[model samples]
Target: MTKDPTLKPYQLRQLMCNSAQDICSKGYDEESGWGIVDLHGAMEQLEANYGEQLPFNDVAMDAYYVNAVNWALKNGITGGSTSTTFSPDMTCTRGQTVTFLWRAMGCPEPRISANPFADVVENDYFCKAVLWAVERGVTSGTSDTTFSPNAVCSEVQIITFLWRGLNCPDALGRSELAAGLGEHYYTDAVAWADTNGFFSVTQSSFNPMGEGIRAKIVTYLYQSLGRRQL
Candidate 1:
């Protein structure tokens, strides 16, 4: 599926046979460390399953991005940047991105703590999201004492954050991961994110410092959801 970006989906039953065989052998272990399951294969399955169900009327997303947007909306992870428009190209704030992830994860409450950052008010919409990230080691503040919640999050930073939240899934099995941008600070995270379909095909550069937008971040989250399906 990685080699064929314009590919359509295969039936789920087609995947079940081999997967069931592996499960039978491995006793249904979720992290069996089996052979590399095609990340594209998982996405194609999801697209086939839910591509036509998108209810948003104003989103201008291309075909590749629609499924991810649909999945995010269907799961109540986002309500669009505006009432009707998704504004896919607009940069996402750290607070907004974290809150979107927190919502997608069922809005678990973090342990009570004193508000550590001066900017994050108790009743702010993303207050709990920031706190949860801190508590879970998903993020540390920009400085030792402050979380610039309104600041824009970068591609590499967000991917690394998501990777950490997922306990940093191994990157060795995927080809793109193994051939990542050499020795940059976000080398490993960019590798994992790329192979896992975090970045869209149009984005050729790793561009770790590039702007992380709402649509792209949601797509990464949606693709990560596919990994859980495996």
Candidate 2:
């Protein structure tokens, strides 16, 4: 198109006005430089792209545990402590902890081995998991022949068990761990767990003998899986 050589001021103004109007389309206005803003439309489009959003009522959406809980759910690591409640604050027993790791590892059958522990009955749910752990050198027992299945496992014990289950990978350095975990048998395990992302960096002074809750244990297991992509 060519401009008229003798275009009048009024005509020129009209042309300019039309040109400016052409810059905007249906969904925006002059202020927005397109058409009208359609927030509802945008939201609907997003829902369509991402699928319908479902709410897990019991899990706190903004809590630090929400991500780990959700990841565990998605990966079949757990279905929560109950259908709707995770019982995050509840302390996990030794049997439950082993079972969690066993389940996460795909519940492999243990090689033929004698069940030396009297407390771990053959008919119990955790029996096979415990035997599997023992056969793989993941755990020994509470004692020579007593697997304290009901006892609350310590953080160090749990981390050590997991480390053994993962084939005992080398941890890089441990000057801080040595200082904090004086004479603690599971110090190396804690260092390994921390180095492999099982424990966060802020946990410098680890209470190795302290009881770990369900939420924290599951979070540790989930993070450990992330390190090796299991």
| Candidate closest to the true structure, highest lDDT | 1
- Give the poorly placed runs of model 1, Cα more than 4 Å off: 1-62, 172-185, 200-204
**CA lDDT for candidate 1:** 0.67
Model 2 score (lDDT): 0.65
Task: Name the lDDT value of residue 160 in candidate 2.
Answer: 84
**Against the unseen true structure, what C-alpha lDDT does each candidate score?**
0.67, 0.65
Q: What would the per-residue lDDT of candidate 1 be over residues 163-202, giving only the tens digit for each residue?
A: 7776677774455653655676567777777666555543
Task: Please write out the lDDT profile of model 2 over residues 1-230, one tens digit for every residue.
Answer: 13235433432332232223223333113234323334455344333424222245666755656656755565456666666688877888889888888876657678856899999988898999999998988888879989899999887778888878877777866646645766666767777776654555223346777787777777777666544410
Q: Poorest 10 consecutive residues of model 2 by lDDT?
A: 13-22
What is candidate 2's CA lDDT for residue 33? 38
Query: lDDT score, residue 218, model 1?
Result: 81
RMSD in Å for all candidates:
7.4, 19.8
- Could you give me the TM-score of model 2 versus the true structure? 0.69
